[model samples]
Target: MYCETDDELVELVERARKYTEDGKVADYIPALGRAEKCDLSIALYYTDGRCFKAGDVDKLFTLQSVSKVLALALAIMDNGEEEVFRKVGMEPTGDPFNSIAKLESQVPAKPLNPMINAGALVVSNMIEGRSTHDKLGRFLTLIHDLTNNTSIDVDHEVSDSEFETAHLNRALCYYMKQHGLITGDVEDLIDLYTRQCAIKVSCLDLARIGMVLANKGRDPETNRMIIPEGIATLVKTFMVTCGMYNASGEFAIRVGIPAKSGVSGGIIGLVPPSMGIGVYGPALNEKGNSIAGVKLLEMLSQRYELSIF
Candidate 1:
């Protein structure tokens, strides 16, 4: 067995802790700037009914871009794939998650994929609701359902920080609106997207959510479907293609699991129908994923034979 006990997993996490020192904590968002830079943790929940946890598993952190997956899923449910596709493309941009060049030069100015900020903002706009608050409530509800944790809440300070520093995303939203790719109020959509990104969770919460995806969007423990099959497939495809910012391709080859990485130093990866692994290491590499997290997942995937490939 790869990590027979929590202690073994803790040892592996400690061994990889050095990688976190190689990266920097996200400072762009002032609230996220408040997180401990050296925080490191891992949590795993297997569909076969095994669980392992190590390190700062109880520390709460903002979801950051990871919330894009849930927002994309809900958007697809509200509007079919084609309609959502109009606002966001399926192709990976291979650029920075917040790259403005892709938005300015791309056809239709549709965001390359929902995993990126532009695409996520576009998708967030399409969430069917009367107002930004309503849409955010629904998005949080979906996350809660998937994790079966009702206490999940947005950190308003983080949301406020992101909202204040969201110039690029705001510009992207305006560009999208001008191109007619996104309808309704641009600021409203941006606010909703920012709020979604600020939602907080721990490694344990993330592992549980990953477990849902691992089981094809079903709550493996509850035996309930949390997401439609079609939407789950779409989300998983996007995760494989664009989850790890610009390093998604490299990660897919090396780590080989459907995964999503957030700038907050959270990475959620899962082997289909098998296991979900969540890692939190606040230091970020050049590609914006947690450095220690990437290394740990690469090793764990190999050791556990958890790669989809």
Candidate 2:
């Protein structure tokens, strides 16, 4: 069960979906645009193997930017903390996730943080891999191992669609390469990054992955350590500061938790020590967050006092 009052959570999701119309689905990425704007779902997983699900929880969606969190962790494991930080800064940029203006003005041109596209591209380059397939294979394996969902993998349809429309991302990578923030072939790095972004998962699958983060890298189901606890903490801290695109501060204040949201209207969040929450609402706010999903999280956080602060 999600908590003592599982039925209340169901009611919460139903209530939140009323606001779905306030935001629009992200259509620039044609694959994501195909999703029903009114679709909404939520799922929760706890370390003790308990689960709670609500409407449309089984709907599959691409991870989009949420994959940045896992990529950051894998990069740290492969490169260590100091080296990774030296390549990317830890500060948040108030600008949009894909904005190139910051790269032109910032000193040294290091990505402000790994949660954004520039930084994620840097982290993607940092991940251990000889080729695009190899890099994505390693990352995908780690995700499957942690979530124990061997069935999950890249959705090629979504990946192809994103690669086709990733002109803005291409510019970000090229800019970073010129500034020495990113190295190697820009095309190869962009390919791997886009592949990671299109990793497909349902809310339930995301909740399982989030559960491991909540448990500090331990898989609650098998009681196995996935990553070092230190890595997990660092990942969560970034989520708190920069995971919600430009709306992170508002999310941290209202929802009060460590979380990451994606352009596909999916959000993966954790309430430390045990609770993991996954939300999906194709309708997105101007800041690119799931409109109804955020509302549901707010209600749960307020009712359960799930914030770490």
Candidate 3:
């Protein structure tokens, strides 16, 4: 859907910036910790190629956990859904995104959903790559194809920084291996996950990819299927239920759209049959969501009746 007024959207972005000061930029990883906490941006792309952007639309950021969505899609495409689902379950854990508490207690020991670190590691390892670099190339190619932007690539420094501090991720991978949920080299899978998480993109890049999902997996310009409709639907449902860390259900209630959020403070919201929206505010709340971005989405959803419900 076309925005009612570009000025209105711009004004909303300005208002949302105030909340950014209350948030904390991620600091666990050295590279991500360097982001300016107040930086904020948003871009919205319609199916017809029209676009509306506000704030720092060109500011670059790593995809972080937002990469999980695409990695899961690629895995499902390489292997059928049944085979992939056998490796990961389709439910929310209600625990932290990286928590292994559930895995310790659950019987199957599969990740609750592909949005979490554990699940993403599993899918990244399944990307049909003979080597880690090849898997990265495949993931990059998928992002370029979906966004129609060939310039996007991984932020190698960020990936390297993440790899250095990925002790917890390494532990999760090993645990999965011991449970037979994952059957690969733990080091290789962690490398794949870390690199994918460090893939570089701006708000505009994310909006285009979201537009493809909004259009039911078909490229609006070429009418070519990027993914099967059923697959897109499955991924979107995961976004609604578990995309955000622990705040997913609250986000769904407030914004009422399918969405995924990254610790880098990027969020991709899919408004079916209309627009794909991308937001980046490098200031996260307690649940690892962009404090300002979520506020902006909530306001926009209310102002335009953008909620699917």
TM-score of each: 0.97, 0.97, 0.98
- Please write out the lDDT profile of model 2 over residues 1-309, one tens digit for every residue: 236655877899899999998989999998888899899998898888888888897789999999999999999999999999998999988999988887788798888999988889999999987888888999999999977888888899988888888899899988888877788998888789888999889998888889999999998778788888999999999999999988999999999899999989999999888888889998999999999999999998987888778
lDDT on C-alpha atoms for all candidate structures = 0.86, 0.89, 0.89
For 117-188, candidate 1 gives per-residue lDDT tens digits of 888888888888998888888988998898778999999999988888999888888887888877887778
Q: Write the per-residue lDDT of candidate 3 for residues 1-309, one digit (tens) a residue.
A: 458556877888999999999999999999999998988888989998898899988799999999989988889999989999998889887899989887788777888888888888887777898898898899999898899989998899999999999999998889989988787788888888888999999999889999999899999999999988988888888899898878888888899999999999999998998699999998999889999999999988988888888
Candidate 2 regions with alpha-carbon error over 4 angstroms: none
Error of 1 at 35 (Å): 1.6
In candidate 3, what residue range of length 10 has the lowest lDDT sum? Answer: 1-10
- Model 1 per-residue lDDT at 12: 79
Judged by whole-model lDDT over C-alpha atoms, candidate 3 comes out at 0.89
Best by TM-score: 3
Would you list the rank order by TM-score, best first? Answer: 3, 2, 1
